[model samples]
Target: MRINVLQHTPNEGPGMIEDWANAHGHPMVTYHPYQFGHLPNADETDMLVILGGPMSPNDAQPWIKQERTLIQTLRSRAVPMFGACFGAQQISKTLGYEVTKAPAKEVGWAPVYRQSTVIPGIPAELTVLHWHEEMFEVPTAAQLLFASERVTNQGFVLDHRIVGLQFHLEPRANNVREMVVNDYPYIQGSQLNQTAADILTMPVLAANQRALFHILDYITADN
Candidate 1:
């Protein structure tokens, strides 16, 4: 299977998702449209992974608009897609749902309670990294998968193939460290924010990798 990733920033590249793809022997490609101003063709994408960024989906930038169009095109084709943070919001917005400011900027590690068992092997509750100021509403007819105290729309699974997660489950230790160093300003004012030292020292949970791989496997599996 061919896996295509839309990475918004150099620091937010696919972490464990790459690991999962390599271990399974699935060929993968990552596109940085934010820099290159181009997206993968829909026909070539068997599975799509949209990684997070500091930008909002609502931005009027040309690349953002193009990304949304590509997302809509892929959805119409029923391609398997997994989006995180801004990527999630892009999917929601392209589906005609609202992407608005969240009640608060949720940062650092927090527990998200599972609302459905659509994806097997996912724990009822899991603590994951959050670093978004905007959230997407679950698309119509989609099942909400998880929720947290700070954000009600922690995740949603649509059509059994599309998954949108507001948190960072695919981030490895180095990924988290880079995010902390580059995007540390977003963590300062929020009550849920964790200090740089704490975030850097936070232990990497094995369950997070398990949950992420489960979702990836389920979405990309043949229906």
Candidate 2:
């Protein structure tokens, strides 16, 4: 499968998702619009993977607008898509849902509770990496998949093909370290934010990776 990755920034790349793709012998083509200033056409992509970034979808930046337009076209084509954090917010906004600041910021490892049993292989609760202050409402056409203490719309699935996750299930230790180094300012004051030491010490990577694989298999499976 040709997985097209939409990387928003240098720090937040595809993380373990790339590793998973490589291990499965799937070729991944990445588009760095933050540096390249352009996006790939939807017809050239088999599956779309949108990575997390620090930017909010509500911003008026030119690249953000371009991404929104591309996401709209991909949605219309029913392209299988997976989004994380900021990417999720983009999908929600494109689907006519409001993306707004959350009551509190979630910036560390936290438990996400499953709201539905439609998707297989995911447990009822799993601790995933989070680092966003903004949240998106579940679109009307989608089914809510997960929720957390601070965010009601942690994850959703649309048409059994498109998936959006508000948390970072793809991040491994290296990815977390990069994020911590790049966005260190947000890792303080808030009770939900964990220290770099604590986050690095967590043994949740294996579990999270397993869940991510299940999600990938589910989305890529033929109905």
Candidate 3:
């Protein structure tokens, strides 16, 4: 499969998703729109993966608008998609849902309860990384998959092919360290924030990685 990745920033790359693709021998291409302003054509993309970023989906930027349009086109083509954090919000917004400010900011490790078992091997509850202040509503056609205490729409699955996750399940230890170094300001002065030292010490990395790979396998499995 030819997987096309949309990376918004240099720091927020595909993390373990890249690992999975490489291990499975799937050819992957990435576009750094933040620097190059280029997007891939849908005809050449068998699957799409949009990584997270600091920007909101509602931002009045040319690249953001073009990304949304590309998302819509991919959806219409029934191309499998997986979105994380800001990427999830972009999917929600493209489906005519609102990506608004979350009632509270969620940063660091948090528990997300699985609301539906549409995807096999996902447990009822799991701890994952949260680093966004914005939340998106589930689209009408999607089934709610997970929810956290602070965020009701933590994840959703559309047509059993497209998945959106608000949390960072793909972040490995080094990824988290880079995020901490680059986006440290987001952790300051927030009541729900966790220190860099504490976040790095969390023992949930293995569990998160397992869940991420399970979801990826489930989504890309050939029926």
Q: Name the regions of candidate 2 deviating beyond 4 angstroms.
A: none
User: Model 2, 203-223: lDDT tens per residue?
Assistant: 655878888888888888872
Candidate 1 local lDDT, 138-185, one digit each (tens): 998899999999789989999988999999999999999999999888
TM-score versus the correct structure, for each prediction: 0.98, 0.95, 0.96
lDDT of each: 0.91, 0.86, 0.88
Q: Which residue pairs show collisions in model 3?
A: none
TM-score of candidate 2 on Cα atoms, chains taken together: 0.95
Off by over 4 Å in 3: none
Model 2 clash count equals 0
Q: Which candidate should be chosen as best, given lDDT against the real structure?
A: 1
Model 1, residue pairs in steric clash: none
Best by TM-score: 1
Q: Which regions in candidate 1 have their CA more than 4 angstroms from the true location?
A: none
Better of 1 and 2 by lDDT: 1
Candidate 1, residue 33: the lDDT equals 92
